[model samples]
Target: MRPCPSPLRPLLLGVAFAAISPTALLAQQTAPIVLDEITLQAATATGTIAAPAQPYAGGQVSTRTRLGALGDVDVQSAPFRAAAYTEELIRNQQARTLADVTRNDPSVRQDAPAFSERDSFFIRGFSVPNLDTLYDGLPYIANPRRSALEGIGRVDLLMGPTALANGGVGRVGGTINMIPKRAEDQDLTRVTTGIASDSQLWTHVDLGRRFGPRKEWGVRGNLSWRGGDTALDNNNAEVGVAALGLDYRGDALRATLDLNASKQDLDAPTSLFNAAAPGVPIPDAPDGDINTANPFEFHDSTHRMIAGRVEYDLAPATTVYGAFGASRYREDFLTSNYTITAPNGDAINELGFNPQEIEGRTAEIGLRTEATTGPVRHRITLSAAYALNRNNRGEFNPRLLGFPVAGTNIYDPVYLPAAPDLSGLPRADGLIPFADLRSRSVALSDTMSLDDDRVQLTFGGRWQEIRTRGFNTRPGIPDFPVGEQNYLYEDSAFTPAIAASWRIRDGLTVYGNYVEALTEGPMAPSVAENAGELFPAVVNRQREVGLKYDLGTVTLGASLFEIRQPNGITDPASNVFSLSGQQRNRGLELSAAGAPMEGLRILGGVTLMDAELRRTQDGAFDGNDVPGVPRTAASLYAEYDLPSVQGLTLNGRVMHGGSTWYDQANTQKVSGWTRLDLGARYAVEAQGREIELRANVENVLDESYWASSARGFLAAGAPRTYAVSASMKF
Candidate 1:
């Protein structure tokens, strides 16, 4: 932790107080503005001004989390489990993307590792699409593949299906929400320069200011650039980002706006989806530093978005809020299909090219009111949300027109050149119909308190509707019809939730909840006989119980949960896809965060999970463990200050992922693995400026292994990496 800056810090005791306070408005009223002047001007300044929950004791996690239409909820009082990685920790760790920040959670794992250029993840043993992430409480604004960490204030993770949380539902796994940064009350200008192992260089600038008589209007902006070769062989990467944030904090009204654009290009991109020849033993992982991609293989993506939100207090205890967001993601890739054939690493490769564009718009409005009726007090909320998404792709569909297969060796790979005169093939010009999706939902909830508010029970439900349609991009292919071969699915479902919490004593709370999530059904894979088939919407269920204890400077928590979801798979014998599968995951989680002592801080947790494929075709895989769901995953991150050195601190982290099967028959397996990371930072005041120097090394042991094998696709882990940077504030 750094010292308070300015000495005359803003009188921002809390967001609620600041909202109605004449001096400081907190969403312009919600967040805590406790940083002193100099500290406030630090490089990690956020763009948003509203935070209902302050950072917990350790400054790495928050005490409150967003609970769907319920809005910001105190952790102890909330029946769900969640984690929010703070901005302060992001800067110290030199995170580059969403995956880097979310690795702190034991229940979350990326299905694709570093260099994959995409950010899909597995939460509680279920696959989560990259397209379903939320930005500032709105769906579809974040980049579909990977969202940059620049200007992001917090990366929030809510485990379990959250269909009731938004119009676009994620898989039964979970949801990830990103909060954009807002301006601080104090004027700030901070710049950072850094370099990574091999040959990567980057720089970032953050600026914030407040204008208006009462400093109610504010602006924050960020610009960043990174380019050069990455740690992997033959990989060259380039990226650029620009972002701006604006806000207003008024006595009864508060608002914020954000605009962002970013682009990434990578040559010799890594492939995360590798298939093993049927009935063949999977090969051991190759050296992590080698490049298996051909010279011609590359990927390019661009992201652009604009989002805004506002709130108004009708009275002291009633508030109305609304939010809207729109975003676009453009993606193009020259890729291939790789299938490992032998244990010695022989593989076959076939080229595939794809180019696509996705766009989305979302909006939500709600009213929250607090009231009293006799001995019971009540908090009620009513909300409605809508989202629209459209996708465009090239005319060529790899599912129907795959290239002739070639050969390669995983141990000593071969790079093949692209065929000349590719005029007849599909290109990244994005000109054909792919899919369009529309979603709408309405929700209402009431929380009633009893017995002096010591015990509370709440019930809520959401009525959601989904309309989706997909078109055959390659109508010319003989396998498809002449006109657009169309597929459409329209459905509606109601998801209900009930939760109870009891504050047994000061700083201690116990809670239980039962929730249901409704989501769009799965689509048949290209390899299946029923390619492009769309299924009806499905509903998932979850039951959980938990407790939290706070010891002033420290906080500890534990929870047990069970979730059941409908699964879809292709019949091995018939090559047909169907929703004839089901999976249930039950887990126990323990977490801790805070500064147990004056100079030492710690954050981490452990998750023990039992995931089973309850029903499969002919019971072929019944009672078997689900692929990629580790039995035991544990992680710990700690920081300590040396009394001998006033402004210096050292930190380290250890992570372990338990062994698990990679196939349905419990055939292919990935061994358990452990990783270590170390870092340090120094802070000092010089020439009227606060300066910080930070350095970190990930995978200190340089271990090479498989990270995940969800959906029968193998994802390789990353190798050792080193990074260093310096930040200066003025």
Candidate 2:
């Protein structure tokens, strides 16, 4: 076995916690506070608002502890599979980007080379464009961004079988929701600046204020900017984002509104596969300053989102909440001077392509109510969603030659223009430069629970319908060829779920859930006479069993899961294959996070899966492991506050993934590799103000590996790099 790369200042924090005692840590917090007893009277319920007779665990961070479910509820509690990424974890790791938070999730996999476009992610073996981007529980889809994390308070990842709670039409993989920062009491603010090993620099500011009786009305805002070069030659990315929000809370109701916007630019370098030569590195480019004119390129995009939520109480045990959100995204990409190598590794550039633009929008609204009666609890929700997506692309498909139009000489480069229709091909009159689509969905779910203070049983059902329409034709070229289709005649589906949990103790619980979910994909363009031939809907069914263990100071969780789909999409339609078959994914996952001891926190997880295509027309992939998904993956991250030095902490993490095939044929493969990161932070408080200094080293050992590879391109992971940052808070 390869030696574990030791992080700076060694020792995982968990290892140190076992050596300490709770009393030693409890001493850090003030002695348990005791309150004086006094005569108390029942507060009268106000007009039209529901009031609780007692307090609820609304502040519990564990509710949103998974990936994306947004603090709304636990995956086991929701009508569908969901995960929440809490704020504590994000702050501790100094996560600067959306992709950073997912590195440790067993259900979410970031493709390859952390920052690549295709480097996005996959859930349950299906490629997702960054886990169903959402804003305040609404779809927040966008091409890609650099500082997307800065605009979010937390992220909720909802996995497969979500056709109900999240609306109808969506990817088979899952969805993601962005929980924006809300107003808080106290004049709190934080500013942090840092530089990475790749010479990148970043700065961020978060501020919140409260000024009113009840402190019920307040404002919060954030600003972030980062720029720098990475280990990859000619590869660099930068971004800026700003967000503001307002909140109002009253005796019977609470409301909030938020607006956020951001922009990102990237200069992507070509990612080479295999050795540049017999002994050269995979990213064969020379170590020097590179320019756009080189055999590489990149572009930019803009994102904007707006959302609001309102909660009202109707009775002592009932409360109703409503949420609405919307977002817009724009993208432009270009490629020139790329190198197309032959199967023999000989240089060739017989191809070139460019994306003039790609843009889309998403909007959603939902209403939900929570009620309780004695030992029973119930929450019902209704929602509507719509999305508009369009892409105008251009590619040069030269026969016998690949892209980069492979120049005979390695020292020479070629430039290409945006010619999508191959300067006019046969049969298909006019260039098919674009495809447009509009999708709308409506859904509802109801969750009913019964508990005897120790055991809880939950039942829920979701009903949904998806309708989509397609169009084609560019602005100037109104006569352009465009394929149109619809799901108007498709059937609406109802998926039901049941779950039971037994609490053995305060910190441990065992849960078993059986759920069924469904989804519909965007219709692909029709190239044949039958316009509806390629527009069929896809659906899935999944069941899972899991255990939850919270040790107060540390939490441990494990789950055994099985998922299957009766029908899916099969690519390369020319092969005459049908998708009316079954696919399955069975896996075991373990995750833990919390303060193991005073000033020490550790987060780690691992997943082992057996995913496969059980049946298909081709029958070739029946028993083979699903391509592009790892069989086993693991991650470990920890941070320790120093004992001798006040306000200082050390952090480190290592992530590993097993290898898998790249295609259905299983003939080609991408090897597995591990990456390491190390960092530290020092804080000082003085005269009503605070300052922090931080730094991190990424790819500490500079291991070379392919981040991702597909039919047309490959991306490499960054090599060794260092960054430093500083921030102040008031």
Candidate 3:
């Protein structure tokens, strides 16, 4: 048994603060000269984006990634599959959140829009919450509902269960990790402003600099604000984001600190609850510009986080590191649920107001070292982690007054009157205990290489303990009194993982891995008799094999994977919900990213899925395709710089999805749809730097269709929108 690493929260914060305090007094955000193409190329060509290897051919992504205990390894060389999208890509795409930037990944999809209150998704046909996302390789720090992208340097996505890397129960579908930006060798002063859709306007400022004699201290900061009416009628949104990053790098010591805060407000938000009433036939989707929620309805969320890390090299081949993070999230919404009841667009709308708050903290300490034997080289790591989250909720909504329901039409939603003030209810502004989660883990692993490093094999295991407590919950129609309640659930497991990789030849590698994850049980729906009941934790497993090829200018990857998962389901006869359902997703994924040819760059992929139910209510739905799991999904986004026209580039993207069943019984399905988007950009020299103007038209044809039927819920697609922006570098 391996001993746990002591908590380093205090030491990590102290070291980082102490290292950057002196340099902060002398740092200059702006240098004398502007940033030019040559300087930009030199800055990126170095190790600014990735380690050892420069940015890939297209400069949109890097082949190297920071895998949990594995440290940094080549994507192809690592047994698991993953990709790290670069800041260059984020800037080009104008991505506002993780969902906006990850659209290029076929394995990842979301039912919500970028302007929505939450950012959630399905990676490999399994649900993933934004709260599980990581910041700087540590969890419980990123925003709980929506992750901001202002200070993010790279978005790394690892496909499949990563319990072996991130100890304790982890995401079974995948993991998204945001790498923070730091001051680069070259100074930067960039200002960008834009307008979107009918009346939205926004501006952003970015600054970076290095200080001290050896330029070992660095600082980077970003701030942005946006607000206006959107393409959807009656829908208005506003957002503010701020992020600051500090770091220090020496010959043997390195430390970093990151701080972020953001707030978002939305009125008459669309597509939050788009489910059709049971036994009601699916209705035709309204126009893209339609806003289903009433104009008086509103939703708002706020997030704040601070994190720090420090690492020191004890020897050339050995190192010690520690990380700590804390975050707070609060949400308030006076929204209503609208359910379609008939094909004629008739629906029932009910108003419900609830406020939620979540607080989380995580810390870790680890040691890594490398040793060699006569015939092999070994890299070993031992680490320990602790994470805790406490969730609280308000009891002002239905507990005191039953929310009333009204009839409406989906095609032409009748605006409702204003909601009553919430300040009157006692404790309406206060919060009651809802749920708490704590996870403690110790992990150790080793990677061995032989035969000139051509063949490699890795194996590891983690001992993890998960403790959960539950309190108050909103039950069925007639609300129950909200009171102090606490329920405790604890479990422990030893999860093992193994992988093997063979470099068949230069620029090509084949790898496979087997992994498992323990996931929190789903809450029973309000319609079930066991409403709000939490099922016992279940283990999810996956098996994957993949092949990779670097075509110099273009890189292509292919993989086949299988996942088995269990969930809670309601029994119609017994009216009880329990962990009696199982699902298996078997699929093949093909992806390509980079500059395949001169004057061109591409990033997109295709996914084919065979998701089916293995066990269901009394085996009634056995062999049926899993609801909302599309048979095929494909997207392609490409850019071409016209050889005849200098400083001009045109790009277009097309997304297509196959049909999917909407219910477990597979009685009906929503047809697939295709969308097209176009954009252009022009760059010219200005003040010794560069100035770029960009424009884009999304949903070119103004197609109106069901965006997603995930979990049997139907969310309508957003309308066509136009955006244009200009950026200047100094």
Candidate 4:
């Protein structure tokens, strides 16, 4: 798994024949005619020309975005079930995170296992923590455990429950926004290099600029690095990233600023799924890139962020906006915790050390307006938001230091013995003072607009608030009671939303939505029986209907959904875990992205869910079936383009999922899997710059299954890997 050298193939074929020669296409058409006569003498000395960040059609897949605040609208008028993935599908799928751009999202999955240093998901079936991602639309500033897509540009994905558009503290199975990367008006520099599949090694840099005299000042920058070995076995990893962005545009003022930093280190990482001893039967899944972690395990993380935004325009249809963001996160983990004593995979392992630190802040303010009364046509918006989070955790235990760490057998593997000197433990920076979280929201929306605009309705509401506190950094054990007793908890809710769309004509549309989501509840764990109870805060309801079509070059969509929530286990004959469970999920979805002809292109989707679990605890998990819900899922991706090799292009992708259930009484299941991927790209143009080359192979058939599950762990699929990249632009 470490090959591919040979002097980099004659330096990539001498830069692909000096980038399609022809004098580099006549010096790129005379350098844009000497930069358009110095941009027409600076546009006649600044009359104006700053409009540039809205032109993405160079490869389809973009139906407008800003999903979740209903801002940039149009995905057939946005009535929910969003999708957005562009950056040309994350650079034609050479994706480098956000789980590789959600692996072409089919309602997303992957709850663990994928170079795990943190990055979890389950989108339409709950659980999406990575600290609840969002950025640009601001909310704690992205960093859901190692997220780096080299300065991202679009990744919308809004499937359900956003509590009236991002505020009531997300995740009733959706919400993920990351849009950054500005500074365009076209002066850029790009560089990229890559490899991965047991050897790693990648590099990237991108820069952009625009200045004064009407280009309205802007700048962008990104840098990246990745290092060594990783398709498992003895694992190893390293990463670093940096970003900077700034913007300004006048005529009514607009501004932006962003900064970021990242770092990650891993060695023998990947280990999680140790809880199968109640009757053992969950083993089978120990191959694919094996490494039950612990070659002196390690995992580290660091991140920093800053964000800002401002907008103003007090007339021609009024507007005002403000946003702020902040973030700091740190992590350190020592792995190995595998407990599946036999089912052919025998396991016992133990080695612990957890460390964490997090701080976040977010803010938002808004006003938007447009009006008309007698003939409809409104469009109002009012907003407010606040979020704060703090967390610090610590743990250390090598069997409490008597040097006890032994147990292994995930299909025969052992290599322990190098970690017995805790240095007298107590690290994680002398941790103490565990949780604190707060979220506040206020929202109002309107969107009327009738007949002339072909009906569009939208009404929103949000008045959320949630506060939480928890402490007791392990003090004298006994259900750990130190300071904060019943772990203070607070709650509030009011989420409401309604939506409707009906273009019913030019390119078709028909949408409907009803939303609600408000989560954060489920405490009481000291072995149940109401141990430190503090519940109340769980509302998740959604209903949707959709259809969209834009046949002028392909685009289609479909939807029908339902969701219900309420969960809080632990009863065992009155042992009290409260909230008395309940779960429901219903669905049907289908989607497609376009470029139906010349040079082909197509994005894909399919989902079919049904999930259940109606009431538990005394009914013993009632109708079962909701543990890692997966009643079918699908995805496809395609690309073509090659009229006799003019800069090549070819691609493929397919992914599927179906059987899933690993507890909650549904007798344990895990089958249903499929995966395939392939890729290629070329593109050229030399001395004038612009070059590209990409390659991909992801699980092309390595197939070792058991790829999804969450809560009841179990994650394995991911093996046949390979990637290549090359980029240039100046």
Clashing pairs in 3: none
Q: Across residues 1-730, which tens digit of lDDT does each residue of candidate 1 receive?
A: 1122212122211222322232321111333223242111111111123533588887988877766567777666676777878888888888988888888888888888588778888888888877888888788788888888888878888888776555435678789988888777788887677778776767777888989998889888987777778888888877777889898998778899999998888888788544553456667777777777887777888889999988887765667888999998888777666777777888887666768888999998888776666566677888899988888877765655545577888778887666434567655454676778788999888888788778898988889898888887765656665337477888888889888999999989898889898787777865566766778888899999999898988888899999998877655446577887788899999998899999899988999999999878789889999877899998889999879999999999998889888667787777778899999998877657677778899889998778887766777788898888777777
Off by over 4 Å in 3: 1-53, 274-279, 396-400, 426-429, 473-483, 525-531, 569-578
Better of 1 and 4 by TM-score: 1
Residue-level lDDT of model 3, residues 1-730, one tens digit each, is 1111223323433432332232321221122222341111111111112222457988888778878666777776878889999888888877778987888888888866544688888899987778888888888778988887878988999999887776454578899889988888889977677778877766677899999998889999987776678888888887778899999888668889999988888887765444453445577678889877878777787888999988777765667888899998888887766667777888888776768788989998888776666566677778898998887776543644665678888898876676666665433236887778788888888888788778898888878888777776554424444554545678888888788888999889899989877666666654455655665566888999999888788888999999999954454346566775788999999999999788899998999999989877678889999877898999899999988889999999998878887767776567788889999988877447576778989889998877777754677777799888767677
Ranking by lDDT: 1, 3, 4, 2
Ranking by TM-score: 1, 3, 2, 4
To one decimal, what is the Cα RMSD in angstroms of model 3 from the true structure? 9.9
What would the per-residue lDDT of candidate 4 be over residues 1-730, giving only the tens digit for each residue? 2232234334433443443344543464112112222221111101111232342233545666674444566666677768777776797788888878886878888678886687778877777776787887776668858588888877778888786767566678887888887878878877677778877877777788989998888988887766778888888787778889888988777788899988787887876664453345666676678887766778777788999877776754556777888988877667766666677777777776657678899887877665656667667778788888777666432334454557778767776767756565555555655667788888888878689767888898888878877775554557766545447668887878888888889988888888886777756644343444456667788899988887877778898998899865443335455666778888888988777788888888888988888867568778887876788899888888889989898999899988787767766566778889888988887666777778889878888777786655677877888888777787
Alpha-carbon RMSD of each model: 9.4, 10.4, 9.9, 23.9
Positional deviation of residue 392's Cα in model 2 after best superposition, in angstroms: 6.3
Q: In candidate 4, where is summed lDDT lowest over 10 consecutive residues?
A: 40-49
Q: Candidate 2: misplaced stretches above 4 Å?
A: 1-71, 74-83, 112-119, 140-147, 269-296, 336-367, 370-375, 382-404, 407-446, 473-491, 522-535, 566-581, 709-714
Can you give the TM-score per candidate against the true fold? 0.90, 0.77, 0.90, 0.33
Query: Per-residue lDDT for 453-506 in model 2, tens only?
Result: 356665555565544333433233235333323223344567766766767777
**lDDT, candidate 3, residue 22?**
29
Residue 80 CA error for candidate 2 (Å)?
Answer: 7.4
As a TM-score, model 4 comes out at 0.33
